[model samples]
Target: MAKIMALDYGLKRVGIAATDDLQIIASAIGTQPTAHIWEFLKTYLAQNQIEAVVLGDPKNLDGSATDATAPTEAFANEFRKRYPEIELHRMNEVFTSRIARQTMVSGGMKKKQRQQKGMVDQISATIILQDFLSRRSNGLF
Candidate 1:
């Protein structure tokens, strides 16, 4: 099966993740600077068999658009236009950052490591990928 990629995109950094070739496991790839993400994607997409891309859709708890919503939408539009061949999907991202922080704390990560913003971003991306796989397997996608 082709791999599915996920992104926890932010203004400064974008966290990347991908499912294994077998599509059984989601793994954190890395975090890339937002400014350089296009270059990274151009190379990675060329080398990998990615079938689709999942991007986090930031929203408030009440389902209203958050401050990040506009920027995320703009990025999505640009992504679609730039890579029309690859399918792009959005998944609600409410508390992914909080969850990632908690995960790192509970996982006994060193304080310095846990405090790294990039680490949290990567974990958040993995969570997004896992959520997509779970929903798709449950026929909810």
Candidate 2:
């Protein structure tokens, strides 16, 4: 009954999300500074049972790796090195930020709240987790 976790990696900060033990729904956990992500994960993993880690794969419209891709890949590599037992998967995250913003707007989030980049990041991570869950459940991952 371990849960699955998702990460929306960014240059300055990272968004985090996790599913329940049943893995039926994804929920935003929080955001953390990029420099402290590993430390945060270490603490989090100690208290929670995570089956795997899903990372958002950033790509350009031409389907090429974006500027953020290399850093994310490096982070994933380090993550694997740090936690060799945990599986890591990447999910396409083409427009997760835009989609998250739109969702917030449509969901009646106030302008002040919407302006919080951390909130957007958390939502984007949730979206990425949900997408990964959907694909996984459909055997399309």
Candidate 3:
């Protein structure tokens, strides 16, 4: 099966994650500067067979779109225009960053490592991918 990739997009950087070939596990790939996201995707897609792309959809506590929504949607539109063949999805990303932080602490990561924003972003991407996988498995995607 082709792998599914996820992105936790930020203004400064984008976190990347991908499922295994079997699509059974979601793991963090790395972070890329936002300015080079398209370039990074070109290289990544060239080397990997990706069937779909999942992007984090930031939302407020009351279920409304947050301030980050517009930029994310704009990015998604550009991504779709660039890669029309690949499927794109937006998964709700409420509290994924906090969850990632908690996960790091529980997983025994050192304070210094946990302080790295890139690490949090990567982990958040992983969380987004995992959520996508679960929803998919439950026929909710």
Candidate 4:
């Protein structure tokens, strides 16, 4: 009944989300600065039984890797090195940010709140986790 976590990696901050032990719902955990992301994730995994990790893979509109991909990959590599016991998966995150922004707007967030980058990051992590959960539910991955 371990939970799965999703990470939306950025240079400055990383958004985190997790699913219930039943794997029925995704929830935004929080955003942490990338300065000690590995340490933070290790503590989180120790506290919560994390079975696997799903990472958002940035891509261009044409399905090519975005400029951010390099850093993201580096982060992923570091993550793997830090926690080799956990499984890892990747999901295309082409429009998660845009969709997160739209969702925030539709939810009536104020302009100032919307301006906070962590809000979008958290939503993006949620989106990534939802996508991963859906695919798992469908038995497609």
TM-score of each: 0.98, 0.98, 0.98, 0.95
Query: What is the lDDT of every predicted structure here?
Result: 0.95, 0.96, 0.96, 0.92
- The C-alpha stretches of model 4 lying farther than 4 A from their native spots are none
Candidate 1 lDDT, 1-141, residue by residue in tens? 799999999999999999999987999999999999999999999999999999999999999998889999999999999999999999998889999999999999999999788999999999999999999999988
Cα lDDT of model 4 by residue, 26-132, tens digit: 99998999887878977898899988999999999888888889999998898789889999999999999999999999999999998999989999999999999
Which sections of candidate 1 miss by over 4 Å?
none
Ten contiguous residues minimizing lDDT sum, candidate 3: 59-68
TM-score of 1: 0.98
Residue-level error in angstroms, candidate 3, position 33: 0.8
Report, for all candidates in order, the number of backbone clashes: 0, 0, 0, 0
Over 4 Å off in model 2, which ranges? none
The number of the candidate with the highest lDDT is 3
Count of clashes in candidate 1 = 0
Which candidate would rank higher by lDDT, 1 or 4?
Answer: 1
Give the Å shift of residue 2 in candidate 4.
0.4
Q: Candidate 2's error at 45, in angstroms?
A: 0.5
Across 75-121, the per-residue lDDT of candidate 2 in tens digits comes to 99999999999999999899999999999999999999999989999
Which candidate, 2 or 3, would have the higher lDDT against the true structure? 3
